[model samples]
Every structure is written in structure tokens, then in C-alpha cells.
Target: MCWEAGLSTEAGNSVDPRSNGLFGVYVHWPFCAAKCPYCDFNSHVHRGPFDEAGFVAAYAAELVHFAQKVPGRTVQSIFFGGGTPSLMDPRSVGAILEAIGRHWTIDARVEITLEANPTSVEADRFRGYRAAGVNRVSLGVQSLREGPLAELGRRHTVDEAVAAVRLAQSIFPRTSFDLIYARPRQTLDDWQDELTEALWMAQGHLSLYQLTIEMGTRYYDLFRAGKLQMPGEDLSADFYELTQELTQNAGLPAYEISNHARPGQESRHNLIYWRYGEYVGVGPGAHGRLLINNQRHATAAEKLPFDWQRKVLARGHGMVTDDVLTWEEEGDEMLVMGLRLREGIDPRRFQRISGRAISERQIAELKAIGFLETLPNGFLRVTDKGWPVLDAVVADLAA
Candidate 1:
């Protein structure tokens, strides 16, 4: 199909589609040295040695399996995310990249990112990762304060986190770090001070997240038992406002709800997800969206590390759930994901995919309530007031 930049002929038609559509790969590493109390992600801590070479082989096989299904699609980005991707040996990383190169055509400017924790031991391997085709690194520096770091069950100290950032900046072409704010006993002034320091240390991007006590996490138990207190709604709103103001002034604006980056420096891998582009996720507990036979399919792999590996070894892939989404499902997902970005969703594109347009009355009502705005580019985005209640806003529009 002949096409212009940033406009797809149909949903899920192109491989490596840039602005209009994109194809990427997400590799999940589900093992960690220790699991954090608040983390609900599929990660495991093993006391004894495990088979690294065997795992790498399984990954290569899985790649070949997905490649057969998604043939001829050029890869635009490759992300190594996990329980700490930095824990993998550089040689393992190199082998995985080699397998990917063999399976599909990779863009010359493809953004390859590896998620790392900021321990000195991990930082020492930064050079090796850069050499093994990781051009970008996102460090999990949850806090810059010792007390909070400990409370978050992070192993690294503040100094180690800073050093790791500096080291990553020196080794990788791009670097981004995460910080969790709105913790118990956290004052606005406290966050301001921490964010100021973080901005000073930041090179290209920052991900600032509010602490949410999710179900099944340790924090959930604490909150239910009256042992933990979070910031009230009003104070949380203040914190959000402060964050936006600080980041905007610092030249790193909120590109997404929890992510801030300089113009032209946004995470391309994540943009694929938010834009509802096609991607294949490999490894335990990984979820993916891909178009097969002109239908969008949602896929998820087994959550247990060993079981996933065994399944992949026996069969070609470890996918446990593969469901074709309905049109309504597509519309709801497009709104839920795209509205998180500052660029917002294209209404015409949504109409094309969903076979329906957003209600003008609802749009006008949302704008009147100060919860939504019409962008100059003709895209509709949630306003500052809307972001805090993003779920409700998206639900109303989806309804």
C-alpha cells in the first residue's frame, strides 16, 4: 500500500511503522536478585545458580517462533525489560541481539533499551551492555533518599544510584531513570527538592510515578491494616501540579502521565504501545499485541520462569493467551492508552478502527468541565484536571 508518513492504510498493516504505525519487540527477563515488596510483576529470586546458556537458547528459539508468524516485519525497537535485565551476562545479550538480527530486518536507527538497577555491580557491566547493542538504558532508581529507598526495598544507596546514572550516561547514548513520589510522609517540599536533584542528574528522560498500593502487594496489606497512609487526594493533586510545573520549566515536559522527556527524545518502544502499534513480547509474563490475518490479537506468556522456558522448549512459543479483540475492545483500548500521551489520539484514526466516531456532545461536555482540550493538531487530549481521574474520563468517552 502506498502511504504517507504517520498514516497507516489500516490498523496493524505495517511492520516497523514509525509515526503512523510501528512494530517492535519486548523481551522480558523475569528473574531478580530480590523482589521488592510493592512489586507485583512476574519476577523470581533464586538462591542457587540457574542455566543462563539454556535460557538464552530458549529466547533464540522463541524469537524464531514469533518471526515465522510476523514475517517480513522490520523491527523499529527492541526493549530488554525485566526483573533487572542488567543481571544477564553481556554475552547472553549479544546472542539475543544476534538472533533478532537473523530473524528480521532491523532499522539502522532502532532504539534498543535495557532496564537496569543502579547497584555498583550492575553499573560495572554498563560498558559490556553498550558493546552488546544496548544504545539506551533505563535505571530503576526508585528514590534518591536512603529512608525511602530502604522503605521501597531497594538494595542500592542514593550515592550508588547517582553514580550509576553518571556511568550509564557516559556509556550509553541515551539514559533515563525512574523515581516514585507521593510516598507516606512525603511533603510537597520534599518532592520538590528530590525532583530538582533528579532533573539536575537527568540527561534525556525521566519517569516519575506516584505510589499506588495495588492489590496482592505488601503495601495493600499495610494500607488495609491501617499501618500505611498515603497522600490524600488534594495533596496528591498538588504534587502532580508541582511535578508538571517543575518538569516543564526544566525543558523536560510530561510526554506521558508518568514519563517526561525532551522533544525528540521520547522512548520509541513505549510510544509503540501507547499508539496501539504491533509488537511481539517474548519471555515469562510478557503481554503483546499483534495483527494476524487483519485482526488484532492480544497475547500473554506463562508467568513462571522455568515453566515458560519448558513450554517454549517443548513447543516453539510459551504463549498461553491469544485472543482476537472485538471492535469495541479496540476502541476502548485505543482511548485508554493513547489518551495518556500529550499528543493524544487521532479521532479519525479511532473512528476508522472502531467504525464509529467520538460523540461531539461528550467532547464538548468534557472540554467544558476543564478535563479535556483540543490540540492545534486536531487531536483531543486530557487536561491537567483530567489526568488525575484518567480512568473515569476514558470510561466516559468509551461509554
Candidate 2:
């Protein structure tokens, strides 16, 4: 299949069928200084020295491999996420970006973001990264309070986070930071104060995530043992509502349930995910979503560093799973992701990808339950009332 722009096609067919014009690239760095107890993101602590040069060479080769697989697709965004991407040497980042530029045609306005922990060591390298083609930085300043920082196992102090943000603002054109709300023993008033402080410090974008105890996390174990004491459901709901109200009043409305941005400042790379666009994931434990010849496919990379390195060096790739999504599965995914956004999902696009529309019966049921509102633009968006009970709404749709 040949896309517009005279790009040629390969022999194999796409795994799943979907057509969304945009595409992105995501590079996951699986090494962190230390793994947070609540993190289960395939990240491991780098206790000893590792081969940075070898890793860079492997990543370059991986990019070449992907370029061959999906030729002629213009890259709109590139995100370096993970075990603290800021830990990467600026030169390595530069080399990877150079390799990407050589392999694929990138959009001139492409948003290349790197996630960093708000430590002085990382902050000092902000300028070096900017010079290396990283235009955006998402600082992992999970909280600005000392107690919460300690609880979350963050290395940086509140002062360090503030300083890092200040440095990031000076260095990068686009800067965003994340905060984890609804912590154990956190009150609504406490969160309100924290959010206010964060908004004052924020340059543009903010990702306020509620702490959830996922299976395999330390928090989950603690909860199972009845040792965890996070905010109760009622308190969590209060925090969530306060977040929506506060961010809206600040003119940084919630574009997604957990993400807030001033108009036109939303994270473009994230938008690729929420909008169901194609993205390539590289490095250990990373996942990629791709569309080729109108077929959609998902890629999961090897979970361990040594394993991923070996696979990349041997087969020129580190992919563990490259499964194609089914139409119903794709529809369900779209519903799950799109509904997270304030604008919701486009009915036409949903039908195009899912092979069926969201049933009117389901829609009526959701509206009757005060969970959704049909917009004039033909999108069914989740109402504020619906957000607090998002899981129930999703279950209703699935049923």
C-alpha cells in the first residue's frame, strides 16, 4: 500500500485495521536510580555501571529496523520516557535523535519530550538536552511537599523540585510536571494547598495523577496486608473534584482526567495516545502501537535490560510481542482511552475503527445514569458527574 507523499509499501499486511494519519515514537528507558515502591513499569534500579555506548548503538539499530518496517510515515512526536530519561547522557540522546532524523521524515514542529526527575543533577543537564533536540521536558516532581515526597520514595526534595522547574522553564520552551494526589493521610485542604502551589509553579502543563495501588506494586501488597491507609473513596472523590474545579479556574482545564493544560499547550505526544494514533516504542518493556496498510498492531519490548540488549544486538530489535488488535478490541480500547479525554471520542472515528458505533441503548443508559452527555459535535463526552464513577461507566459500556 502506498500513502500520499509517494511513500512505498512492504510485503506484510498490518495486524489490525485502522487509519489515523498521525504517528509518534516513544523510547522507554528502563533504568532508574531506584524503583519507587508503587512503580511496576518494568523499571529496575541501576546499581552498577552499564554500557551506555552499547545501548545507544543498539537503539540506533532498532530505529533503523522500525523505519524499514513502517516506511514513509512522518513522525509527529518523539517521547523519551521511563526510569528517568534525564539520566541518559545528552550525547546519547543526540545520537538517537540523529538516527531518527536519518531514518524517518520528522515533522518540523515535532514535539520531542524527555521525562526527568526533578533533581539538581538532572536539572543541570536541561540545557544540554535542549541543544540535543529535546524541546519538551516532563519533570517527575510527584509532589512539592516533603512528607509526600518521602512517602512516594522520590529522591528530590520540594526545594529541589521547585529549583528544577525553574531551571526547566529557563531552558525549555515547553515544560510540564506531574503530581500524585490522594496520598495516604492527605486531606482535601492539604491537596488544595499543594495544587495551588503547583499551579503557581507550573509553566504550562500539569499531570495530576491519583495514587492507585496496582497489583504487583508495594502499595498493593501493603493494602492487601491492611497496612496501607490511603485516602478513603470519599476523600479521593473530593480531591478529584477539587482538582477539576481548581484547574479550570486557573484556566488550565483538564484536557484528560489527569492532565491539565492551557488551551493549545496540551502534551502533543500524549494526544497521540488519547486520539488513537500510531506510535513506536523502543527499549526494554516499552510498548508501541502502529498502523500499516490500515491495519493496527501492538509491540511490546523485552522487559529486562540485558535481555533487551541481547535481542536488539541479535535480531536488530527487542520486541517480545507484536500482536494485532481485533476490531472489537480496538473499539473497546478507543472507548476506554478516548473517554478519558474531556472532548471524548468522535462517533464517526469510533465507528470507522470499531466496525460498530456505541450502541444507542448504551448511550441512553449512560445518559440516564448521568454519566455522559452527547455533544453537538457528535461526540459523547463523560460529564463531570461521570468522572468520579468512571470505572462503573466503562463497565456499563462493556456490558
- The C-alpha RMSD in Å for every predicted model, in order, reads 4.6, 4.5
lDDT of 1 by residue, 257-331 (tens): 999999988999999999988889999999998877667889999999999999999998999999998978988
TM, every model: 0.95, 0.94
Model 1: runs farther than 4 Å from truth?
1-19, 120-124
After aligning candidate 2 to the native by TM-score, how far in Å is the CA of 242 from where it should be? 0.7
Q: Model 2: per-residue lDDT, tens digit, 125-175?
A: 777888788888999999989988998889989898898888898888899
Going through the candidates in the order shown, the clash numbers are 2, 2
Error of 1 at 293 (Å): 0.7
Cand. 1 Cα-lDDT: 0.88
